[model samples]
Target: MKQLVIAEKPSVASDLARVLHAKEKKKHYYEGKSTIVTWGYGHLLTLKMPEDYKKEWKTWSMDTLPMLPKQFLIQPLPKTKGQLQAIRQLCQRKDIKEVVIATDAGREGELVARWILQYVRYKGPVKRLWISSQTDKAIKEGFAHLKPAKMYDDLFYSAQARSEADWLIGLNVSRALTIQYGDQLSAGRVQTPTLALVRKREKEIESFRPKEQFTVELSYQGHPLTSRKPLVFSKKETAEKVKAQLQKETAVVKEKKVKVKKQWAPLLYDLTELQQVANQRYGFSAKKTLNLVQSLYEHHKIVSYPRTDSKYLPTDLESSMKERLQAVAKEFSLSGTILQKGKVQQRKVFNDQKVSDHYGLIPTEVAPNISRLSQDEWKIYQLITKRFLNLFYPPYEAEEQTFVILLGDQNFQLKQEKVLEQGWKEKEEGVSSLHLSLNQELPIQIKVVSSMTKPKSRLTEGQLLAQMEKHHLGTPATRAEIIEKLVNIQYLERQGREFIVTPKGKQLLTLVNESLVRPELTEEWELHLQKIEKGKEKKEQFIQKMKKEATRLVTEIKQSEKEYKDFALTTKKCPECSGRLREKKTKQGVFYVCSNPECHYKRRKDLKVSNHRCPQCHKKMVIVEGEKGAYFKCQSCSLTEKIPDKKAKKQKMTKQEERRLMKKYSEKAPAENPFASALENFQVQD
Candidate 1:
């Protein structure tokens, strides 16, 4: 009898098929000599939507706000019913004796496979194939030593608990707020914490007080030596007094200390870390980066697993390091010196204990041939491949010398030059280049004088991050995500790399319950979750606490009398009633809707254009905000267009003017897609 293996996605199933010799591929299944591989697309089954339980819960009403069920029910997603059915058929096959859960090796992955098995009531013996990297060798080894699925029962239970809890809190609270506030305000465990973080940062940015300081410097032979500024007082009068006193004297030679420092190659990219780096350097959002990385992992097959939190690898895969390194070296033609460095496998980059579900993203053993991949896929693939090669090479070591001089009672300092070792960083190309040295010594033309006061070091994002790292609000893996979430939710805005708060975000912080928004809450939760993973803490206990906290929060919200004001920019009142018109977001785009519950009046604000002309009637178009984003619509014709800004409508445009511009720019020739008009009301009512 053959062993049946199930993977999370078709890409993974295909990879496993190749490894298990599963050559015959079906639409939803793959057959091999000794294995049958089937796959799921993310999730095949999820907790039933509220409307699935009862009809009345379909509409947003305070009456149905906390729609928590006595027991959770799993139902196949409408789009994935065929796939789920195929898996169920495969499970019932008489020849398939032992089933292998070959899905993702993480909590979500475990849940994905288990839910399908439970939903279908698969009653066969079960085993688990756990492997991070999807190399043929790793897959082969994993199959050879498959463990009983019962070993992961606790993990499954934990995942289930989280799912149910998220459903209970997220769905209930989201519905509650939407009903109470009378808007489509969706919130979830991840999104809420994310929003709170943003609001907090925005608040900080709003209250920030910028101050000015002064510094003095001295000149050495052909080199500029700068002094560190010391502010004697926070008052402007004292600052001016110090500046005047400093002008009376010149700088003098004081003391000099210089040393060499080594900069190690960065650990390999995990998904979150990669997202952070891409966001900082390329301005790509986390979701965009995740989508890109997923393509590289599944479609390109150039990068290792992307949905990883670990920045390290397992020691068992250590033996394959040389071949993998050599493979990347041959493909990228990295520095000859790096390839010759004798594939040094260091524990610093590979430790099994540190890696949970997936190891850090790395290059696959297969050589990356980018001919089939799109430009974006190639870019993401290159990032992973280059980072993998850099890890094996030696650190980018640097040697530096410092010269210090003092004038009067103040001290000044200067650096001579930067010298690079150029080992691992050599392989990095394009945007992947290392930012080794920014303070390079320049030739200065001035005579040596008395030492001056030292200058203050300005804070960079990197520097502020160093401080955040010390505080330990989040791990290196999650810091970027935390920061990005804040920005996306309008809690924080970037002034260069510095974060600035926004008013709405500030108001959110002042209005929401403080304990729910505190960073320590998540920090503590993380610590406990880690313990639960290690079996040091009971998952049930942790969940009970979370439930208790959630209930208390809900109760508090219900009792609280905090007032919320609508931040609408539209002047038009509801056509159906006297209620004010406000922006209501739909999947299609934003539209003006009546705030009154009884009045459901809405307008498309149709500013969408096609080929610079409105789609409805041929004319030039003007851009307007909709639920989805921004779009150009005909001003003359009663036509609308859709735009792509995911954030809600900006406050500038008025409703009537927006609608007028959209009609004026309507396309003279109509487009074939008739649903464009229907999309304004296309929200999934549930």
Candidate 2:
């Protein structure tokens, strides 16, 4: 009898099959002497919609809302129905002795498998394969000691609770708002609070009143007297009085202090921290960073798990330090330097208790092949590799000199820092050649500068990630999706690197329930969800709380005294229905969508990406068909390239050209296309 192993993705199934010698590839599975391997397309089954349970809930109406089902049902997503049928057939095989859940080892990953099994009504014995890295050694070890699937029931419960709760609150409240307000408005337990955070900042910027201010400073020999803290004056008159008094004063050196300062490297990369850095440095969206790092972990097999909340490794993993370091050293020439140091472990880098779910992002034992990585993948891989290597490096040291001077009985400080030792990096320093002794006298030069007080800046994607992490609004895996969903629905948008609240977003805050828009609501739910995961609380209790909250929110929207306006409406009308077209900004550039609910009219605004890249930014440029000709416009840097010659004749894509482009952008070959192609082209020696 063969044991069935269900993997999360087809590529992962290929890896598992290779390790198990399951070489007889079938249409949807690979079979070996005693093992059969199958895969899922991420999630083939999702919770059933409200309309599926009750026909009355099909139409969006206030009275029919708060559609609470006694027991949630599961259904196959339309796109993956074929995969679902294949899985169902595999589960019914009489020759199958046991089933293995070889999904990604996380809560959501657990849900991905369990939902499919539940929908298929499988009653067979089941096991789980849990591993952090996708290396051959890790996979072999994980399979050698497969655990019973019953042990991870708590995690599955937690995932189910989160899904159901989101359905109740997000769906009910969204329908009520859209119906009562007569606009396509959306609000969720997590997304509403996220929007509130952005809109709150916008309000702060709008209400801010700049004020006039003055500050006093003293400089000598073209060197300004500076301090770590700036000196501020409440009013110009007070600053003018102090400046006039200090004009006749001379600076007398009171104290000279010099000491060495040391700074250790930052802790390792949790998913959120890595996403924030990638967003700040490369302008990568949270979703983009997650995808790149995930590719590194899964496809490349060079990095550990990407969906982690911990920044520390466990004490047990310390033994693998030399191998990991040497593996990375081959790529980064500095690895030998790090290994030469006899002992290279830091307490902050490894602690048994701090490691949870998975350890911080680090390179696996797999020797990397840089030639296979794309430009963006190489960038993210280099980032993780550098951070992992820095853990073993010594602390960076610098020499600090602080001089306090007395000018008219007021103390002004001048500080200088110079690099004393380079650990992982060299510090930038600028120290003057002139030396001063204690009690030395110098002429004081005072200058008054006028400036206005500025309000807090808008939140960038990185800053928004930090805020979400601080309040526990979402997990490392789901937070990126939440941010993307907000952007997808037109509630918030990106203006350069910063987030701007749209007109509809502003009205959403006023219309949503007071508690629904507060971060604390999601924070509390997350706390309970964690408890449920740890078996400290019951999942049923959390679902009940969500149902109650959903009912209350629906009621609030039903009786709301306020109104909502379609701020997205535009002057353009749809050609088919003559309905007003509203401008929509999606991840795929911009589009004009019909405002009329019954009219299914939408058109692209010609901001789509072109195959050609900008000469400067290397980003894809958009080719817009205009009256004169089709021109290439860079969305990022706004560089424009016009080709007037193309106006006379339009270009068409040939079959050969289309096939070439398809080959460039597609993933691995299809599963039905024969696994022989995969095995024939690539072979792993390790």
Candidate 3:
């Protein structure tokens, strides 16, 4: 009997099929003599929505604030229903005696496969194919030594707990706030706290008061020497006095200290670090960087798993270091040198206990074709390759020197750094030059500088990701998505490289309970989830605690005296309900919605005047938002044209020329046209 293998994504399933020799590709499954491979499109199922449980839960009301389900259910995603059905049929095939779960080797991956199995009621014997990369060698080895599906039960439990907890807390709180405030506002266990962090930083920036201070500096030779302790005098007179006294005296060298330090290379890229670096260097948002790296890992098959949190490799992977190094040696000179050396130094990067689901992101045995990669993909691949190559290189060596000089009653200090060896930083090291000798006294020049204290800079995407990592807000895989969600929901705005909290976001935070806006709650939940994964904690206990917390949060919010103001009002009136339209921000940009609670009128705020002129009116057509989709409408003759699914072909006209033509046509038009009489009658009515 043949075995059925299910992978997480089509790309991965194709890779598995190629390696397993399942060449005959059917509609949804690939068949071979011994096996059949099918795939899911990421997640085929998700936790059931509140409305899915019962009809009463459909309405947003305070009475149904805490809609806790005794048993959470899974529903097939609308877009993937066909794929799920195909998998079910494949699983129930009589010839398929055993099923293989070949999804990603992670918690969410386990949940993806298990939920399908539970829904399909698959009772066949099961095995799991766990591998880090999609390389042919790794796939072959992984299939040869497939593990039992029972081993990942705890992981599945943890995944389910996380999904259900988010649903309970996020949906319940969102409904409670929306009902209380008469606007659609959302709050989540992780997203709310992250928003609070940004708002907190903004508050700090707003309340910051700058104070002017003065400091004296002495120029010895060409180097400026400042006080060892930064002496910021509040009074400029005091600094002037010190500078004047120091200018009359000659400086004497008091002491000199020198130390040689070796700076080791940075650890390998976990998803967070990689996102951080990419944001800082290329101005790529966290989501953009994640997408780029994910493409490199999945589509190019060049990098290892991109969603790993561990920055260390498993000890067993050390056996393939030579092969990995050889793969990149053609592109990187450091790789060639390392291969020539024939000995990789054992560093902190190789730790068995530290590795959880996958090792650090690295290059696989498949050599990358640089010409085939996009610009962003090439840059990210280079980053990973450089980090991996740096592992085998020596540490950066530098001579750090500190000089102390006595001038009057004050002591001045100067530090200089000299690079003795470039080491791993050969291409990136900066140049430094300083001439100093011990026991040399030189003439001194003094200057007093005044400056004002500056507030802390706003958090960049990179800095925010680092903060999220530090606070354990979300996993590496989810942090980028969380940041994008915040931006989409109008809680955070990206101005250049910094994240600024919106006024609406601040109001939302003020209304939410304090516990819900703090990272401690999320961090505590993460700790419990980790314990659950390790079989040290029960999933039921975690759910029970979350239910109580959710109840308390709802009660606190309902009882609070806080008020929410409608700050997003727009001048446009809703065409359907004649209600006042309010501006709303989403991930896809801004839109306008009706203020009436029951009204479902909404439209995109962006409107473009298309070049396609109305046939009857002979006027420029404007793209108007409609119930179905966008359509071209003429304001003069009321003529409408349906926009094509593809790009509409039209003649280009300058705005000035169009405006002139519009004026010319409106002032003097052909009276013989049938629409002209209607237009004249409409104008007379106006």
Q: TM-scores of all models?
A: 0.75, 0.85, 0.88
The lDDT, on a scale of 0 to 1, for candidate 3 is 0.87
RMSD (Å) per prediction: 13.5, 11.4, 10.7
Query: Which one is best on lDDT?
Result: 2
Better of 1 and 3 by lDDT: 3
Q: Give the TM-score of candidate 1.
A: 0.75
lDDT (Cα, tens digit) per residue for candidate 1, span 325-349: 7777765776676566636533488
Tens digit of per-residue lDDT, candidate 2, span 174-208: 89999998887899989999988898888899999
Candidate 3 lDDT tens digits, 1-686: 99899999998888888888899999998999998999988889999998989888997778877999999999999999999899889887889989999988888899989999999999989999888888888889998999999998899999999998999899988888888887889999899999887887888999999999998766765677877587569999999887777778778778889999998877788989999999999999989988998888888889998889988998788788888888888887544467976454538888889898988999999988888899999999999988888888778898988888877677788777888887778655444466667677768777888999999999999998888888889888889999999888888899999999888888999999899898888988988998999999999999999999899999998998887887898677888888889997665657888898779987778766789999996889989977798899998888888998665666589899999999987895557877877776774443
Ranking by lDDT: 2, 3, 1
Give model 2's TM-score versus the native structure: 0.85
Q: In candidate 2, which residue pairs clash?
A: none
lDDT of 1 at 370: 65
